[model samples]
Target: MSSPTHSANTGRIILHIGTGSFHRAHQAWYLHRLRESGNEHALDWSIAAGNIRSDMNPTHEALAAQNGMYTLETVTPDGVRAYEHIRSIQHVLPWSPDHAPLIECGASRTCRIISFTVTESGYYLDSRDRLDVSHPDIAADLDGARTTIYGVLAAILDARRRADGGPVTLQCCDNLRHNGEKFRAGFAEFLERRNLAELKRWVDEHTTTPSAMVDRITPRPTPDIRPHVLAATGFDDRCPVMGESFAQWVIEDDFIAGRPAWESAGAELVDSVLPYEEAKIRILNATHSCIAWAGTLAGFEYIHEGTGDAEIARFAGDYITQDVIPSLLPSPVDLPRYRDVVLERFGNPDIRDTNERVAADGFTKLSGFIVPTLRDCFARGASPSATALLPALFLAFLARWADGTLRIPYRDSLLDHQEIRAMLASEDPVAVFCADRRVWGELASDSRLVEAVRTASHSVNLWLAARHGVHNRK
Candidate 1:
């Protein structure tokens, strides 16, 4: 075990929160490559990883056992694969019931940047992009307890402000739309709810939360991967992460306390990450959901399995090429080329990205990814045919849920048992689903959007029925 060491020699630390597969594969791998970049200062930037939730304890313990050294299996579409040892994570802080250690690290002087890869739902934001202070965890944190990221961050920021721990950058590497800005906003609201005026001022002045766009297809680790890594690397790496060979990180380059030379190691440190963020969310994230929901309804297990099916592939490509691309047209990014690359990534047979994983957080995915392009298209007076299919597919997916057909867990941070009951009882399930502020935002009230979703849901129902060799009476 590397233990906890602090020094310029050990590398200036980035205390990364949420030690998930994506972090190990993307952010840590980038830092690992930076360490290999032969730059003197790059050696000083390392990750001390932890998680906000206790369910991640297994992965955390595995990393702690391996001294945060694990094999990263990179597979390409053409079936090329390589296994490399990722050693950038120098310290793995095991999960604690109370995050005292986490707060301490945030209060420490050695670490100047705190990066996170908690999924989109981890943000706990309402439809208005404000912190859902009513969320039990957020409320608990507001009541001087800790649980959610906001709670943990509040504690860390409080400690930092009190100790003069200096400024730290909160780099959000999730698939969030305008992640940095949204995080800053929600965090500010969280602080306000906690009534920490002095600390809030300190935060506004000292810290910088930079938006970032990160891309990689690191699926959930499987048991077979553990044995495969042992065979490939001759080491028992319990937390070995496997992903596609493709990876990219685009940061807004707005750090308060300096950052690593990530650009030197295949990251793009840009002045603004909006264009990249828009392209990624619309073309990649949205279409990913499109394929997943469609795939799930069609009874495909993995993403590649569905993408390999010509019908599902055409569905995804049509949505992107018809609706997403046109909405992103006349832009800085070559939309067509970006779409092609994303499709290629999704088609990686070795990745085995499960459709259920992609389709789980449909409520958040719609607003963050699918809805933006939809709103853009509608504002520009464009038809919502291609984009409408996503909500339709989600509705059908929900219908499967109502009928007890969905085998995998569909997690929504805000969804309650009562809401599920309401969904099942609702006569107009599609309208009711679309009307939820969480999924459609203000678009819920848009008559055109609601009607489009209804029509699209019917169309998707027919398509799904045909795929299953069933003829609908209607």
Candidate 2:
């Protein structure tokens, strides 16, 4: 198949640099819809997709063969429907040794925004929430006299600086709380380490990193489903994307280089995104972790299947409402409504959000999404009985993976393997669970919570052993 040529579009070009399925189904689809509403001229937006990983070549070829357009299968409660000709993207750039084109695209006068959905690990932050310069790729970039933190951004900024252009908005659509602030801190740290204080100052003064809340359930496409996707889309897309019908993007209005009246494109541009971020992170993401770990151990595959079980669903809902929501810092949220919405989203049979997929990256994910709720529960003098089980379940999941009962492809392969091995090799699972300062941070030393987690870990271990007849087999 021949690669598609870039079409001329009058909108401000938007570059989305990620190979993940979620980016294609969620962000790219949103831009496609915005363009379809006769706003393409006004928005002047087109997406040039790129991936940093070498394994993404197949996806790049498929997307390019389809002319930078494909189908989005949205499975909603009502029904499943295919959206064709979702034409927001203009081209795909496979991983390359030279990133000059990507740098040039981002620095172009016409390119107003750059969005990323690279998973949590993509940020390459250390435990201290600073850039991890020791990362192999980061070291290579630095060795080549390029700035770390994805040298493309720095290169673009340099190009823009040369052109005397204003800074572009760097929008992050990741799952991190205060994601914008985290990116700013990481970028600043990266600059400081390289003695680029002047460029750092320019970024601080000219750029805007807006906090955003993005929600969607996009699963990796399996071989069995590839044919269905091709049939529905009429394209041989190797990495066609699938997602739930529900989607949302809430952003704080803080763009410096100006942006598409994304509000005009159906995005909610609010004066403050803190409330939305808090609600989604604490309620949505926290509950997701609970469901993932607990449901996986309970022998459930997809979220809808697990949530379909009354007991498991109720446990998750109650944990969020009774323990997690009340512990949040801001004023109380509508726990009942949020729980209902979560259950509904979870029950969307079309979503097919797998437990194993969600359960991946337990180490980093637990600290960011689950630990805060656990800590908050402790602060409010509340029992984290149900909330505490989440970490225990995660530990068990890691243990299972370590014992070769399950397998997952992790982004930080070395760190994940080492952590899992260490946990598995520990004399007492409880001690290892409680003493891991990196995993639990300061909460590791809290006697009360430590005991609670230790007890929970023991129970989970025993339960798994008994349920799976490990003892009898031994």
Candidate 3:
């Protein structure tokens, strides 16, 4: 283990919550690269990362033990592997149930940016982008619990206000649509619910939350990664991370306090991240879920396995070609080339991205990733048959999950287990699922969506029946 030492640079910090593989591989890697760029402003900033929950305590311990340094392993689609020792995270705060250390760090005047990656469903928003105040976690947070992001952030901001800490930016690095704006709205509403009118006003005047689009395919470390790291890098890195060689970050350039020169590290500082975010959500993210659910149903263990399957690849490719690309016409990005590149990246066998990991938050993915394209297509008087296959595959996957036959755990942070079970037990599960206001919103009553899902579900069933030997087998 590297000997722990204080950072020579001081006065500016980005306190990133959720020290998961993606955060380490994407944001932290960018900072590491920026520092290596020898830019004068690079050394003036560093990361202080921690998690809100105890589940990542092991990661925290390992990272702290290594003095916030770890090896990042990345592989290209052509099987080229590379390793870099990442030292961007200068401090790894110990986890506590109450988030005391996190709040303290976030409340510090020197901490100019507070960023997080809690995944799509962790935002606890409905299809209309409204915070679900009725959610158990949100409700608990409103009652002074610190289990959720809103709760923890509220505490942090409140302490910061009391300390008269100068302005800080709240940067959201999740895959959710308009992540920073949505987080601001949710946080505002959460404060309203908690009766913190003064704090809300203070936040309105003192902070700027910028939407960002972050992309990286960082998979959970498998059993063999540690041994490979030991042999290759001479470090027994307990908190090592692995990801695809491709990565991207597009952020709205609206920081209140001074910020890092991240553009030096290949990050795009944009006036608006909308076009890029929309393209990524509809094309790459939606198709990723489609392949994962389809692959899971086909008994494939990794994403590359499903992408390698001709039929599965056809379904995903057709979704992008037939619906998503047309819906996102005249985009700044070359949608067709982006789709091809995304597929090519997903087909990288060495990445070992798992179906279970990709397929976890299907409920959130349906609304956030797939529904926009369907809505746009319908608005333009076009059929979204190919796009419809994504939800159909998810519905089929949910059926396996409801029937206790799913090979892997189906974890949906936004899923209401009892409600889903009731829906699945209903007379027509597809119709019931299609009619869910939370998932379909105002489109729930639209017959076009219902009929499309019904038809696609049938096709999915037929496909699964033909692949019976591999269906849900380990």
| Candidate 2 lDDT score relative to the true structure | 0.72
The best candidate by lDDT is 3
Those runs of model 3 whose alpha carbons end farther than 4 Å from true positions after fitting are 1-9, 96-100, 126-128, 132-140, 143-145, 360-363, 396-433, 454-474
lDDT (C-alpha, whole model) for all candidates: 0.83, 0.72, 0.90
Q: Among all windows of ten consecutive residues in candidate 3, which has the lowest summed lDDT? A: 1-10
Ranking by lDDT: 3, 1, 2
Compute each candidate's TM-score over C-alphas. 0.87, 0.84, 0.88
Better candidate by lDDT, 1 or 2: 1
RMSD vs true structure, all candidates: 3.5, 4.1, 3.5
What clash pairs does model 1 have?
11-44, 12-44
* Candidate 2 lDDT by residue in tens digits, 358-458: 77667766777778888878887888887777777777776666777654433333255676687679787667767777778888867877787777788
Model 2 pairs whose backbones collide: 10-44, 11-44, 11-45, 12-44
